[model samples]
Target: MNLAELSQLDGPSSELLYNFGLQPVSNRFLSGNCQNSAPTFSLELRINRDSGLIHLGKAFPVDELKPRYSWLTCFEPEDHLDAMVKTIINLPGVDKDSVFGAYSFKDDSTLQRLDYLGYTKQWRIDPEQDLGISDPCANVETYQAVFTPTVAQQICQNHGAADVIIVRHVVEHANNLSGFLESIRALIKPNGYIVWELPDCERALEVGDCTTVWEEHVFYFTTFTFKLLLESAGFSIVHYESVPYPLENSIVAIVQEGKGQNNPNFSDSRIVQEEIDRAYRFVDTIKFRRHAIRNKLENFRENVGRIALFGAGHLSVAFLSTLGLCDLIDFVVDDNPNKKGTRMPVGNLAIKGSEALYSEKVRLCLLGINPRNQSKVIAKHSLFEEQGGQFASIFPGSEVYLEHIS
Candidate 1:
């Protein structure tokens, strides 16, 4: 669909960049065979012309689609938490004795890092205890559901408002983005600051990484759009930095409650148009890569008997679903014991431990883990390579074995 056609959904100022078609939930790894009956949702990315903010269109209800939590922040996608804690402590008003509050389990590692640095007073929201969830995991929902002003006030009443709130990698998953930011105000003292960290989508949008769009992630933010969103929400950006990685950069920002000025850059017609053009290019690149990668995988499957994808994380799920490559892949390999013996949603492809790579006699396994871990994976599986088995990166332009596809 064209931009004009998509603009009708939200407003004239909002235009759809790309529709990922219908996709299954990313984190659902089931023990039974239920892929055929799995639910799907339309995953479309759009841009707000006036604000230059890119977010998903028609996001599924969080309560209905939330999957069982298997990921732990301490594991993957290195956030450099030690450096982040030092940075937060060095902020003007923050110190080792500052009262800290965290929103979700994703902040566990950061909270741990803070403790290691001698931060005395800290608390994290417990779904079972704080929210009085009888069985939190029975009907899963995004943590943002309880991230309300009322809940924040109650927390403050119980223990004083925090001096610094560390929210790591949870904001982007928020469906009600504005309300989530507003709730932070109620949770912190007037003079308190917030430590925010999220995935930076600037490089992903420029490179058109189809794997960037996860069903749970409702918003995609570049550094420019992120600053714009935070400022528009009445928070001043005290400090900002981008931590670089392979697929995307991690955005670290210190913000405080205050009157924020709208970024003047968004008002410039040239800058707004450039954002629109970048989005258009991103859509075009996805279309091209989807077709090219599918063809390459098909040809490889025809020539090579067995092929598997390494890493059963959301990135791999997005790559498989977006490119319609699930049927081409034999199975998925992950090192996580929790994922083993489970099946990926939509394809019902069995998720086996890394040992399957050798026992199954797989050839040409596509690397789906983070780019930073690529070398470690190769080095760990050197025996696979020694026997003439090849490993290819799903990332475009960063191909190792299957360079022709990228």
Candidate 2:
């Protein structure tokens, strides 16, 4: 998995890699039939030269939408993250004082979550600088505003290897997952463990979630492919299970270094075709579904004016392009401090904090995200609902009220 380790592979090892169906991303490419009426978007899903991951194709115009921070902002959920943390905390034999590196917390949320969970305390972060015995160990449980790879590496190399490393939703953004995994292994003690939470690739198909395929995402994953990635990095799977629904379709795999095992059927050609077929089926129908949603929104617009969108996440962009409802939205409402005041990538509507809703006097707010949060959202903004505000969900099949007070 490490660059150095890759160079150490002998001819037979390399040949076995190919025979075992571990092909380099060099063969990864995109090929898909466009729906005659599919709205053009900068994002498209392509095969990763294997069955487990899907790569985003070239940018194309979709209802005047373009890409923004494909790799920067991954837009995941808070509760789901909390659950991942709970999973790690529940893992047996985790050393409390053992070094805990978040690896890629992306923001202070993970650090904050760990603290909130009564795990670790505040630790000042110094970038790429050595920390003495008294200094914070760059642990995921330590709170810090910003963490760069250099800072992370310093922590990885500092003192000794990490006892428990946690990486969440970061693999898809990685250009070289193999190298990253190897690098992580070197940072951990032989007895250390890693917990990785990734969005389930096949779950996207099962739930009819097309937004999962995008340029920012370098790959999608299923257990079969992920096992390949872990084993290739010389890690052994200790525990792996998908998080429950009403939550994102994700897996938290607890791993350690040892002989890696992969499913024999995953490498089969027929199996590969089946996986590709499932992916293509989703992509093919997405365009029509997007268009249909747009029409429905327009229909509702006939009755409701000055509508608002409930979430300013990636789904906001997906909704705008699919519904061409950017001009129709008043502002995108969200609780994330970072998102407020930013403009929706394509919608160009201002990202307003949830508090912004209290003063809007709006009648209807189209739920741009999964309707799952409808009740909580409405309760959180009681004034909005009390002022005769209502919500409509944007799920694929129909525009149902994921939650309605009436």
Candidate 3:
């Protein structure tokens, strides 16, 4: 029978039949109960339109009576759907409907979902790849490198060459900054240089970006604060550079390998006073922002039933903690498939997929995605509306609530 005629039988007899195109089937084998012996089960194969790479396979089993052999179509094979479809159709004496039910192209849309699971690429660190070595020959014989902390040591070993060892931004994350730096200093060669980079909170505050303060970053470094930190750890700044970037600012310092020295600019009494003053200013700014956020949340509650937060990254954790909105948010959603079904840091809220917003209970979706994907988010919002869901943004100036058309 033709393919269209065979499609009519949806019973067990027609299940195992499959069609094979111009490709060979030796590489693929049936993986169910009929492994060693042929038994009474068989399968068919056919070319699927959706994917040129994969062929559809169906499997069906038969029984032989004592007097005369009759095809006993038990049930559709459940074990190997793909292989069964490919095997049964190519076999002779097998009735098209009895062995192979019907064949259609396999759905390729699921491949996109697979790509979202981070299975598309294989990344490996090549030993020969350059590590941005600007001056490879600059005192190579005398310049021996050392790595501070255990993690940095592992990274150096992975690279296979240790020329320069730098620690910046890491101090803020250390439990004991003094001990951490001291350990690092022990690793440095006698005349080698140690470069440390840290975030300039003063510059970040100037831009009104308080989100820079995070759990991972416990210490905010300014020129004065960093100098004090280095001195405490038996190091003195030999050179310093403030490299300005559009986002959060940074300061790079070249520290010498020697004992700690006292800062001439600040005496013992003045140093204590300056640190106290900086602490008070930071607290005041945090209080003011918290007050502003409370007022905005009160207004937000008046219109929406519940808020669904998007993006479950570090920035979102900081925002939720600072604003004290952990209780206010209904749930958190993220585009990354791996993040789904996982709990968010700090708040411990379960991260869900975009489908969570489809529930009628969620009235507003508070977007916290990175600014780079803002346009893609806007386009997705339009698609969400087509499915009868409303859209809303909660950022300061770009806030908007869009009602969905039924």
Best by TM-score: 1
Per-residue lDDT tens digits for candidate 1, residues 1-406, read 2222222236667777877788988766777555454578888888887766777887677766665663422343555777888888888977777899987777878888888889979998777666665544522245667668887788788777999987877777776666677777788888899888889988888988888888767778888777767666667779899998877889999988765444333456776677778888888988887787778888877886578999988889898899788998899998787778878875888999889888998878899988878989999999998976888988865857354642
Which is the better candidate, 1 or 2, if ranked by lDDT?
1
Over the stretch 70-102, how does candidate 2's per-residue lDDT look in tens digits? 222434555667766676677666635655665
Which regions of candidate 2 fall more than 4 Å away from where they truly are? 1-42, 58-98, 106-156, 260-265, 269-271, 322-324, 334-342, 351-363, 369-372, 380-389, 396-406
| lDDT for each candidate structure | 0.77, 0.54, 0.43
How high is the lDDT of residue 58 in model 1?
70
Model 3 vs truth, CA RMSD: 29.2
Question: Compared with the true structure, what per-residue lDDT tens digits does model 3 show for residues 88-124?
Answer: 2222322222211000012122222223443232111
Candidate order by lDDT, highest to lowest?
Answer: 1, 2, 3
> Which wins on TM-score, candidate 1 or candidate 3?
1
Clash count in backbone of candidate 2? 3
Q: In lDDT terms, how accurate is model 2?
A: 0.54
Model 3 regions lying over 4 Å from their true place? 1-163, 204-210, 232-236, 245-247, 258-264, 268-278, 345-348, 355-363, 369-406
Please, what is the TM-score per model? 0.90, 0.65, 0.49
TM-score of model 3 vs. true structure: 0.49
